[model samples]
Target: MPRLIAPGSLRRIGTFFSDSGYTREALRDTLELSELPWRKLRNLHFLLHKTQEATALHQLARIFYLGQPADEALLRQCIPGAIFGLMQDAEMLEVKGGVAKPACMVAPLENLVLVSDQITNMEVELLPDLVLLPNPTTLTVSRFMLRKRGANVFDLGTGCGPLALLLAGSAKHVLGTDINPRAIEFARFNAALNGIENVDFEVGDALAPAEGRQFDLIVANPPFFVSAERQFVFCDSPLELDGFSRMLAREAPKYLLEGGFFQMMCEWVEVKGQRWQDRLDEWFTGNGCDVFVIKGFEFGAAKYAHERLFEANPLHPERDIEIFEQRLAYYRERNVTAVHGGLMAMRRKAGSNWVRIEDIPHPPKECFGDDVVARFAGQDLAAWATDEQLLDWKPALTSRVRLRQELTARDGGWQPTMQRIDLVEGLASSLALEPPVASVVCRLDGSRSVREQAAALAAEAGADAGVAQAEVLRLVRRLGSGGFLELPATG
Candidate 1:
């Protein structure tokens, strides 16, 4: 294969893209290409009519973003001759019979233009080592990542290296490792294309490249699909039945320095007669880490097979039933009742560790790095502090917290029947609150200590002061674990 990337040439192509107004904002506004629900964005039917204009932006979108061929004359008219020559030398542009097209797909991801293999239409035709385009999961993992400056980060299974490249902006250094050599090539090319020097790519499975090295943060979007076959390196693990996820959970802590975090987007199977939490607990037990889990969604065996089949071959509806049956049979053999997908983060720490799980309706839309750090801190405090010790600590509601009440029409007036507290930003958690719980939450302003607040609440409710203090401690622990309140650390 010809070298499709050169340092200087990639820089020129980036300049060309910028000069042509090929940007994320323009793609979203003009072409309707967006970040979420990437299914609609991948189909070219909607863009066919929208890209009819002959502007440079539209032409670039057609040839690169939409994977359409452009006339050689039109390409010349749109791209600068110098840029065109550089692309040709780099083997990025393919010209045949006076029609020009991108040999690889180039699409805007946030502030970066990522290049990867053309999205394949056939599952059978997909090579085992194909480098994949940035999908919704990539965005999810990126949003879930903690952005601590000057940290040494690792991007495991870093296909195409988008996560590593994104972290390079703030990280002191980043090392990305992948099992696929083709993926490593694309990752290195992308790093050069973006002119990012702080990140490096290595070809290795799991953590082999980082042996004997410790990192401040490690993030992965590994091949966690619970598939029976290893057809795609980007999604299918060679290990059977979600063992890859288990392996990561079991071994990731070995590479993390004290207080460092390991975060990943993964899918795990829920076996018959076994709780998923217990299964995951087995993965992290005695690993010396405080774990946090977010279960975004779950699918029964049949539904999971159907979704996987459709994603593997969206164009071939006729083959769906056959492939679906095969996958279903595989799941039956493994006793997988359901498959759950979500994000998992583990912080390496000593002493009695805690595992907290949050069931979210969907993945968070914005970055919640600080919220994640705070939640870990809160969990640490809750796990170690005694009730009496917690009394001296001041707990405060998060800045964007809101209390909403459900009112019912009774006796010709509205009556509050239920109340819920919502964290408008960060984790975006909402939980039901009792009258007493609401009252306690409303008063936590970091002004008065928990002991004082408990006494006042006890006096008002005519309840035992000890019982009131216990309830307040329970509420504080729950809210703190969910990122709804800030608990200052104590000695």
Candidate 2:
């Protein structure tokens, strides 16, 4: 059993972690044992292979992340003696098979180190509803969250409290809710471990615990994985075919203050006839919330199952094939075409809400919360702006926005083959420009209106100004909506 670390001991442990450079930002892709990075250790792969050098970080990682037993002497030497003693007293350090091993796994995300079961490290026993380390979805929602200070925040399905911990820094108060009692314990343990006081954990399911509650921001990484069966509360829910995710999208608006934002990571099943976008668009119907959906990589239903089952069957690879087939059959029986997953951001607007959905295959190298929030603001401006207003507004290209020319080698020399304009360092999106559109962009320097620039391009190319005007309007709308350009004056 994993016992809670005492508040007094948590401060000491936090100080030790800070001094040791034990952080997600510090260990990102740096903690390597054999061939795997630290983040990849989230998967239950056995990390019995240790590097030649035995630094404190390397040894601690072996004990904490890989769930391998460290010699009692070596553990005392690597970890602070007082903290080690505290952990031992709290039963966090267990002697299994005469070897001292950590009772739980610790994963670093931003400023916090989340504690959960080392299920992937298990060699024999298997059970459903096992707690998991931070996966891509956990990182995705936390990374994309808007960091609005002094806001009341809620983290639903807050497994191990990674998202809630991250939000506590900016939110005035943060509450994490989960149906699993163990998850509530883990989340609370992590909060005390990090000495974070603004967050409180509650054992509650979905929005039931949040009825009649209002928050300035509600951030959830709910159990939205599309599966025919519910095996785990973290990824699988009792709700059918993304019902829980749909409920959050549809009902979370009622729990938010006016103009408040609700962001979550979710998955949706694409049916035979209905498009995933259309289904998702319908989710926010009559909710009075403006939505922005950032679609991520999707897979055929079976492939998604195969990948998911791989994580669950880490200790029994031989059984993965069987489990995969079982999961795939369930999806096939339900007629799930493709399971689409992504980030959904919604704002509880008063009336006449809008929906913006688009595909974003690759995420940025790191989270830029302000940049993402600003994209929604920029979208609002571009969405409502008329062609005449756009021209009159004379939107200035952001400092980060730039144009790049792609050149190809010919028989003799390289020649410009394509022109692309995008936020060079902003929101990680782009706008490919044709000759005329490229010409118009070249002159969008806050120096000329769209109409004036279109006329200049028409004169230069001997084309109709009306044709140029219409084409430029289309390109500008795309550029603005996609965050390739922005109107600073409006802001």
Cα error, candidate 2, residue 165 (Å): 0.8
What is candidate 1's local distance difference test score?
0.82
lDDT of 2 by residue, 225-343 (tens): 77666766667756888888898888888999998889998888888878877888789889898888888878888778876774445466778778888777777777788898888
CA RMSD, predictions in order = 2.6, 3.4
lDDT of 1 by residue, 1-491 (tens): 12556687787787678777888679879687653223435655666667767778888887777667888888788778888887788777789899997877776777787777776433335566778878788988888998779999999999888899999989999999999998888888888777888998999988889899999999999998888787778898668998998898889989999989999989999999899888888988998889989888899999988888855555666887788888899999989999998889999987888898988867667887677787787777767778888789887887889999989999999988999998877677887887876898999898988888889889988999889888888888777767787755310
lDDT scores in order? 0.82, 0.76
Top lDDT hit: 1
Inter-residue clash pairs, candidate 1:
none
